[model samples]
Target chain A: MTYVVALDVGGTSMKGGLVTRTGEVTVLAGRPTGRENGPEAVVEAVRAYVGEIAGLGRSRYAGPPAGVGLAVPGIVTSATAVYSANIGWRDVPAEAFVPSGVPVRLGHDVRTGGLAESVFGAGRGVADFLFLPIGTGIAGAVVLRGEPYGGARGWGGEIGHAPVWPAGEKCACGQIGCLETYASASALARRFTARSGRTATAKEVVELAVAGDAAAAGVFGEAIEALAIALASYVLLLDPALIVLGGGLSEAGAALLDPLRERLAGRLTFQEPPPLRPAALGTRAGMLGAALLGWQAAGEHDVGADWPIDVLRGGSVS
Target chain B: MTYVVALDVGGTSMKGGLVTRTGEVTVLAGRPTGRENGPEAVVEAVRAYVGEIAGLGRSRYAGPPAGVGLAVPGIVTSATAVYSANIGWRDVPAEAFVPSGVPVRLGHDVRTGGLAESVFGAGRGVADFLFLPIGTGIAGAVVLRGEPYGGARGWGGEIGHAPVWPAGEKCACGQIGCLETYASASALARRFTARSGRTATAKEVVELAVAGDAAAAGVFGEAIEALAIALASYVLLLDPALIVLGGGLSEAGAALLDPLRERLAGRLTFQEPPPLRPAALGTRAGMLGAALLGWQAAGEHDVGADWPIDVLRGGSVS
Candidate 1:
């Protein structure tokens, strides 16, 4: 069977996979993003990664890889990387980086991850749901009627910048009291450092909170409250059936989810509260989603059926 | 040529109409909701209003009324009036009230108003937009891809209850600092009364602010700030192409729109701002939208063409 080359590009690393038509990750590989060198080096790194995957697909699969899919962070409008603070790139023609003559698909990393979750992960079987990744900054992927809604200008998922506290703190986006200022992983770490005068990663903060450290607990509590308010806002507007939490902060698991569910429940009065579930695929979701998009680009009609829920739940693809 | 019977049921009144297939309001009438009598009384009032319109349709139109459409306040699910605080209704089988032999369509008033705006009023020609009515309470109707989205349980559009200030005043919905508590017309009036010990309508408060009353200016300013925050949240989530404001508060017109637009501009950092415009149809939007829904129930295929923007702009049907 034919395969597709998929790449999930992050600031620090790139995950590459040769994905078969049956949703199997036939070959998986990785490489440093090399952004320390500069933007052009990052571009070259992405190109080489895709080349390696395509080579592996050509030798191992029934036919040459039919298409390539790339998932990049930041504002992606119609396949062009508009601007990505993570990659330090501006207006990059991303689709052109793939091998010539191969059909290619490009998408926002969080949105692509959301698509995978909606079809094959935690959000499986839900007609309407939201996928939120609380990493360096918070953004959401609104899945309505089985497709992601990009809004009028593809700026739909900037949930991080939504002002949760209008008079509270100034956000990096120049808005006051944005949800990301308190809820994102980076925000949790930053707030913990500011409060306790000890630098720690968000994971460390979660551990500290679990260990009953008052400072860490307070910081995490604030994050949970802000997330709850922002999510309540989303529920009122979209009425999603589920909210799938992914990204670095979600790695905190129950410590993050339990409080978030409680806070969200307390805030909603008339609206039905949706379940908050952890991302099952972790980092693999983006690459798998990119492969799905690639299959679509290659004119595969049964891509949805290819990645059945049963196979995903069994963890056979990863 | 067949006609449709339509009723826009409100807390205090029912606006009834016999509308032709071409968006023409052939006859219009009104009756007291008699809600103080009881929920059952209100139901009878709605039924009587529809019956009157059906009678008008039979005599005035070429053929008998082919269908009936009803728009009501509060949560609506599958043509069932689930709950309405305004009408004191719960699980009311609303379709049962319509005379047999006539096809019936039921929807939330705000959503049907949004539908009319999407096809014939301020939001015409847009694929996605939000319709918000700032009456006694704030609610939104999100129109996507030319149809109104009611969400999973038809409980979408309850934007009034979306918490804007976690530590602010309590709302009727039991939430604190909800957008409606600060931004809605009733909120403005009530807050003004509480602060100044003066009973005044929201319109009077707007007039006072315009005439340089410090207390009124402060209350109205808070309202504008709350509206901006709530709207920013909506923009970050749905990213509608336009936001059409209707109901009593919208009657303040430039007094309301000017400051709201300015405050919203300051909050959005990366997202392209959608235009905020006054609802073109005014109060008639609800009735006209009900009529449109009635036509759909009657099997009118060319309703979109019949509702060209020019006719709606002319205000002739009203």
Candidate 2:
């Protein structure tokens, strides 16, 4: 068995762990990703975290790493970080940041997470699936034959940018009517905050909607409608076998998925509706995806990779 | 040199040809693919055409066939013929119709056309490309790495059905506001006829638009705007290297591509606009894709098998 190092860098935090081919993760390590000083500083944090994790794993394990896979958020150029809309970085070299000889692989975080789900999570046994994370941002991962279909530049699966409504709401990307403006976690809070003049988490908004609050319910329905609109467009293009919703809004589970599923069904003209399910691994999907990719790079599975509990860090399509 | 046979079937015509691996066509044969009598009539048409073409090729050349590829319009399931909206086909047993002794393959017409373009036509050497056929209908083909990416159920690249206006026009598929209503050859004729109270062909409308006719120019500009909108959405998803417009509208050449390029470029926000080119082969793409698939099935090329062609032909994806 060989150990695989996995890193999942997010907008707010950096998560790392040593994982095995079986999806077991240990020697978990994390630190603030430190986006305040800009993207280069985040790179430093990543480097430091990876060094410590690799050192710990080496002291505890019996074999060298099989490979490493890192997941990052942004417009990736064939898994190479090109720009992060949230991280404020331009053309960050992912493989270059890691020390030589590690054989690092980089992919969009959502793509990796969706890959994890396709292999081990909710998407197991499904040949075609879409993992859409409705959180602070709305993005998707298209999994085909257990692999994510990363577009030419690896910036594929950016469904949020797909223009649906003409001249509706302005997006930060300078476009109008982005699904993110209506369906993301930030959208939920913003919608409620705009009406009630009080900011509440997406979770709180869901609770309010469930307790017979008409305004919150209306906003919730709008979010569901937006999701239905966005997903219907995707269904027209790619009829995925399953759709697994992840990230913050997904935490509401049936409260969100059930309505969204019905709304999507109502919107379909001819194609069959894909199954909607909750993401099983939640945030850990990133770690599992990294480990899974590392194993893929190694070309085989290694159970011993899990035993090195102390290992450090890490890292689409429609 | 091994000879490859390609077949493209439209609502009214069936186009077939023998092409070399270098994308050269030696023999071109065609017949009216009459579907009024249902799927069986179409199958008979295909078998008779293939027999005549393949027999003549064998008589003329000592080399064995590389492969055979077939393309059709409609909703293909896992590369198998399901229900075709344009041809009025349902559950057609395409594979049983092909001659059993040799390799044959099937695919969506536009996608296979895209395959032909990517391998031997305008999309050669393009890393990512979308082939849009603006004919009786406006469907598309997506090529990545010189191979078409057929989505789930072999319906991937159905750009025509993409919703353009929610409450605009009711399509035959029971949907409101499809891209097909604006950008297709039929759309141009319909728009012109609606404005002038006289039935006219798209070619005549284009000619009028070229000669500074106000009404014709308005319809032509509308078509260009709709094409720009749909293609812009496609760019957000895959960001392909090029957009190759095929079919009858492509006959307009620079008049269609130049203005469409300008309008699409003007609408971009986060994406870098891709160049637009006219499809090289007007109607022989399906035959070449069929031939490519046949060659692949014959173990000539390691390219994987596509599903829809499986029913019309025999081959395996490597």
Candidate 3:
């Protein structure tokens, strides 16, 4: 069937699988990223992980995949320049991480996840959507016409650093009042700890909020309000058909969605806010998006011609 | 010698010119928009402007030129539904303003201006640049690879409405602390008047600041500081190669760019500070942009197929 391999390279872990054309992923594997040693070590680790995935694919499918796609965190200049704060790698050329002529495609991890959800998962058929993953930090990927929007120099869907609480908290990025400080899982945990004078993980706070604990409820409600503010601005600017929520906090489900929907409804009047929905594939989305990029890499010289609009629409511009 | 009629619609007036492929404008004239009477009046004004331009072109050019390119202020949804607060327009089908069978290309005014600048003006040869017109309200146009980034819904450059002050004065758009309320020329006048207890136009304020008037300098400094904050966020997000200041505020020349550059330098690192330059053309940018669009409307059918990359690089996804 000539399947492809997809990988998500994170600061602490690498997760990926062999994906078929139908969006099915097999040969799943997880391993430590060991990125603290810097760019060279990170490159070697990614090569080794991709090799292991290739081995699994050959052993199980009895055929080598057409190509490989890899997703990574932080600012991605192109397949040529990968600078990541999470992984501590600066300007690592993407083609250097893979074996020669294996046909590797590189993309921003969140954007790739957004592509996966927009194409094969929850955001299917929606023309515009914001994929916001509220985890240890909050970052977003914007999808338009089923393709992720990478702005000038590939920095469009950067909603996390979009400045949430201008006077609220100081971020490690040296900015004041970033959204991640309020809406991320870490934000939830911090708010709970600040209010209750007791340390608790985000998961614990979620449980307490569900159980109707006043302090936890207050913190959770505050977090939802912050999310609403950020998403409301996004709505006015992008006017997406829907918004997909992902990451660790999204697992709380309706507890997050209902309040968010209410807050968004209160603020908007003229804009057709995208319907709210859950991300379909979970953490595996990055891998799937990378796989899609792989498919593109293998088919780059085909009918599409790698034209920008074709790259954006997978067909033509509207 | 083929030419097309171009109509540049603004909140208060409609300007028209016969534009050639070589970027020449002839027989320019303008009439009051009188849009308060609603869509019908606006359409009539537009029709009259187009008629004059068409007459001028027919009398001068030999071949049957293409259709018209009309630029208007508002959130344009396709060739229909133009939403403008000043003009009091909503869901007004733009094609209704044109003669039947005339290929009319409708575009947001700022985006159209951006197109002109990118192709024929100061931004020429720059792969990426952002155009911020500091008029009564501030808005931006993202130009990449010789085109404007018109988001999925044609609203990519809404930098004015992007939040700058967390607890700032309420905006008519129902948002608080938008960049428009601080950095625009109108904002400078308002802030200076309130601060100095003496009413002054934005230009006068700049003059006073240059003359070392403390009160004027303080208020002008505030406006520059606000621009710095907004541009910092912009640089982090889009990372355009250059930023061109346009419109009335930009007319102040070094008065606007010099301080804003210093403030921005103080804020960002790791990202190269793009050289800030003044927009070469004056208010004529809109008219020139409209003409450019008309010239392209003559050839857009061929270009549409390849427009997405330019769009994405321009902000196709928002």
Q: List the residue pairs that clash in candidate 3.
A: A151-A156, A241-A274, A242-A274, A308-B309, A309-B309, B149-B314, B311-B316
Give the higher-TM-score candidate: 1 or 3.
1
lDDT of 1 by residue, B203-246 (tens): 99999999998889999999999999999998988788999999
For candidate 1, give the DockQ. Answer: 0.75
Which residue segments of model 1 deviate by more than 4 Å? A34-44, A77-95, A305-318, B88-94, B308-318
Best-to-worst order by lDDT is 1, 2, 3
DockQ of each: 0.75, 0.46, 0.31
The segments of candidate 2 whose C-alpha lies over 4 angstroms from its true place after superposition are A27-29, A58-66, A77-80, A85-101, A196-198, A296-318, B1-5, B20-24, B27-29, B62-67, B75-95, B195-199, B207-214, B302-318
Candidate 1 docking category? Answer: medium
Ranking by TM-score: 1, 3, 2
Docking class of 2: acceptable
lDDT of 1 by residue, A1-318 (tens): 888888888889888887777776753646789999888888888987788778777777756788888888877864588877777888887566687788887888878888888777888878799999888888888898887778876778889999899999988888899999998888999999999999999999999999999999999999999999999988988788989999989989999999899999999998769999988677788887888778877887458544755433322222
In candidate 2, what are the lDDT values of residues B1-318, reduced to their tens digit? 667666778788887776555444554646788888777778788878777777766775655466666777776632357778767777775564466666666677778778767766778778688888888877778776567776666666767877766556776667767788877899899989889886779998898999998888999998897788777777766668888988998999888988999988866776678888888766666666666766665676743233222222222111
Query: What share of the reference contacts is kept in model 3?
Result: 0.28
For residues A136-239, what per-residue lDDT tens digits would candidate 2 score against the true structure?
Answer: 88888878655787777766787877666645777777777777887888888898988878778889999999998877898898888778877776776666
Assess candidate 1 and give its TM-score to the true structure.
0.94
Q: Which pairs clash in the backbone of model 1?
A: none
lDDT of each: 0.83, 0.74, 0.73
Chain A TM-score for predicted structure 3: 0.90
